[model samples]
Target: MSITLYALDGCPFCVKVHDALEANEIEYETVWTEAMHSDRNEVKRVSGQRGVPVLVDEDRGVTMAESEKILEYIDQTLAQ
Candidate 1:
């Protein structure tokens, strides 16, 4: 399973997702996004928006934004 998290440094939402992933022992790759929304091309390419804490789960064909929803999805699909 390949999971990629699009995050920005110092973003609390991103920290939440990062913490959850770590607590669950779920291995994932972190794609650090730019601070400026206009510079977040990679995030927009996958998620249609330039929001931090975007999650791309290739194994599930899921690409989503927002921290709460991402956490919920992780719990439902990837939590042990």
Candidate 2:
């Protein structure tokens, strides 16, 4: 399964999500929203909003916004 996290460097929520993923030992690619302007637009297009800590699970075909929910979903899905 491939997981990707879209975030900005200085966002507190983004940091929380990153820490959560690390704590859970979940492997994922981090896409910095500020650095990837084009991809950021794509994320907004798909999610219908511009938000930090957007998590995409490619294998499950799930994309979600919000840090707390993403953490919970990851924990539930990846915790075995």
Candidate 3:
């Protein structure tokens, strides 16, 4: 998939990002991370930080973290 979302289960922030993508009808692959922050090595490697709700859009050459920023990005760029 061109877009990949790194998220943790039961995270509200992560849910927000996921909802944005879904609302926009964007297709993305999801990588569910471990509940413990220390186990989120893949998230850190991809996003430079182990934060839930990390978005990686290879097509846009974008990788970012934070729920609000990700939501903004989706609205500004990804939203149709």
TM-score of each: 0.98, 0.83, 0.96
For 1-80, candidate 1 gives per-residue lDDT tens digits of 79999999999999999999999999999999899999999888898888888999998899999999999999999999
List the pairs of residues colliding in candidate 2.
none
Per-residue alpha-carbon lDDT of candidate 3 for residues 1-80, written as tens digits (9 for 90 to 100): 49999999999999999999998899999999999999999999998888789999999899999999999999999998
Worst 10 residues of 1 by lDDT: 43-52
Question: Which portions of model 3 show Cα errors greater than 4 Å?
Answer: none
Q: What's the count of clashing pairs in each model shown?
A: 0, 0, 0
Task: Report how far residue 32 has shifted in candidate 1, in Å.
Answer: 0.4
Q: Which wins on TM-score, candidate 1 or candidate 2? A: 1
**Ten residues in sequence with the least summed lDDT for candidate 3:** 44-53
lDDT ranking, high to low: 1, 3, 2
Question: Number of clashing pairs, model 3?
Answer: 0
